[model samples]
Target: MSDFIPVNEPLLDGNEKKYLQECIDTGWISSEGPFVRQFEERFAGRVGRQQGVAVANGSGALDIAVHALRLGPGDEVILPAFTIISCAASVVRAGATPVLVDADPVTWNMSAEQVAARITERTKAIMVVHLYGLPVDVDPILELARKHDLRIIEDAAQMHGQACRGRSCGSFGDISTFSFYPNKHITTGEGGMVVCDDPDLAERCRGLRNLCFQAHKRFVHEELGWNYRMTNLQAALGLAQLERLDWFVARKRAMGRRYTELLGETAGIQTPLPRTGYAENIYWVYGVVLEDSVPFDAEEAMKRLAALGIGTRPFFWPMHQQPVFEKLGLFPAERYPVAERLARRGFYLPSGMALTEPDIEKVAKGVKEVLG
Candidate 1:
């Protein structure tokens, strides 16, 4: 059997080890250190944001962003049903209700039109996720936000370099969050960042990540907060990962193109489309929709691939159907038809940074064999 190709892998070939060694030598391995500050500044600059606050993980970053927005009981934040549960969990954790909406089938992102229709007096924000590294149609979303005076928080965990109209994903939202898990476009082992242009919000994020104390004094705890700080070691790794972000994104794009080329003609499979006016998609994971005419369902295909040492994953389950959310009776299961269908039929192949051309061929061949 061939070596198993993963869905995604981090590329850390730069000064990661050297930076880590420096951190160890300087005894600044904890959350408070120069490396963390430097990493935040560099990442903020890269994302065209004025500030970046490092956190323990992407979920933590979301929690902090929601807190900064002051979204509490009686407030509702609109989000896509077909997204990682963290997007909804963060809102619930922040004491706000998550108003789930359907995703646009082409973009696999929250539908701006759907969001516009769902807004109400209780709606305080809209959380748009750039699912699978494809930038959500932010222009319309931003326009809607402006008209309604609603905050837009981008869940950019899977889209590190994705852009639209020359602006990066993180720059489009009032507060944007990124993940650095190993499977992401970049990795810091396990870390996240929250970026924003508002100085007060940024400062509040910094405080929220560190016990909500006034930064000047150590023993001051002015408000509620959590210890969601990232360590210097993680920042060292992040700096290294950031250095290779462009290279990683380029290789991922190349792989995505190759996949489309190889699979476009395959029967009963629909490749994702890159819309005009969108910036380069980083292809965090290469997703394909299995038409109803396909010989096998997504689960069966995934099982066969796993047996062949080729790992595959299904798309996110719609939040409305989740047991925890179902009990809340907030929305009916059949409301988001697109999201429900995607959850049942969509699956992504391995497009890891480490994947070679032959790996792509093998995956394509395997899928064809299974389907045929």
Candidate 2:
């Protein structure tokens, strides 16, 4: 028997302990602590944003970002059908309609052309989620936004250190969001942040994160808001992780290249695209999609891999196919072929920062053995 390789394992051997010790020693464990402010400032600057509002998690950040845009009934937000449910759920929860577009078969990102086709006069924003490892073709989407007077909410949760052309992914959105989950490029145990250039928008996000509390009159709320504030402990860990982000990205790239090399000759699966016109794949997770010739779907493949002591995760189920949304009469009878196919066949291997060369070789061996 061998060790079971997890799909993700965060590496936190940086200044995480020292900063956490500082937080504990100074009694600043709440969101008001110094580390929180430091993390917010540094992370914002890193992404070329003017302000960053740290939140409890990535989904909460999406909720706040959608809310800050003041969307409601009669408003429509166009997003990808292939992304995490949080993207559409945020708009749905805001009383706005979520118009979904299909993903590009190659990149697995929302297609700009599809987005253009879905836009209506009622469209208020485009929630662009940079998927798996590559950024969405954003320049066209930006042009469409400008032409239609639409807001851009960039979901850079899987794109921490990725860029499009020469610009950072998170810097492109009117309101950009990031996740600091353990599986993400950076980890805070659990955290998220919203970054933006507009001071007013930034202020609105800050207020919304704190339950819309009045600065002059504390504990009194006027508008509705949620307590999605990130604590000092998470911030301390995030700040430390931020310092090593470039290194983490490099390690991930190396790991991806290695896996691509090892598994390039494997049959019945399609590996991630190494590069696109706008940006290279960061390999957030080294995803593999089973080909039509494959006898088993991702579920069976994952089960077989699990039997071989390898942990795997399925790709995001399409939002249009989600039963919860179906119950709400959302995306009724919607069919996105590319997204549906990817959802059924795609799964990722262990490509975490903590993964060693031996781990990669073992995982690749297991995958080849199972698929063969």
Model 1 agreement with the true structure over 22-124: per-residue lDDT tens digits: 9989999999889999999999999999999999999999999999999999999999999998999989887798998898887788767789889999999
Cα lDDT computed for each candidate against the true fold? 0.88, 0.94
* Clashing residue pairs, backbone N/CA/C < 3 A, model 2: none
Q: How far is 135's C-alpha from truth in model 2 (Å)?
A: 0.6
Q: How many pairs of residues collide in model 2?
A: 0
User: Model 2: per-residue lDDT, tens digit, 194-305?
Assistant: 9999999999999999999998998877899999999999999999999998999999999999999999879989999999888999999999999999998999999999
Each candidate's number of clashing pairs is: 0, 0
What would the TM-score be for candidate 2 when compared with the true structure? 0.99
Question: The CA-based lDDT of model 2 is what?
Answer: 0.94
- Those runs of model 1 whose alpha carbons end farther than 4 Å from true positions after fitting are 215-220
Give the runs in model 2 whose Cα sits over 4 Å from its true position: none
- For candidate 1, the 10 contiguous residues with the lowest summed lDDT are 273-282
TM-score of each: 0.96, 0.99
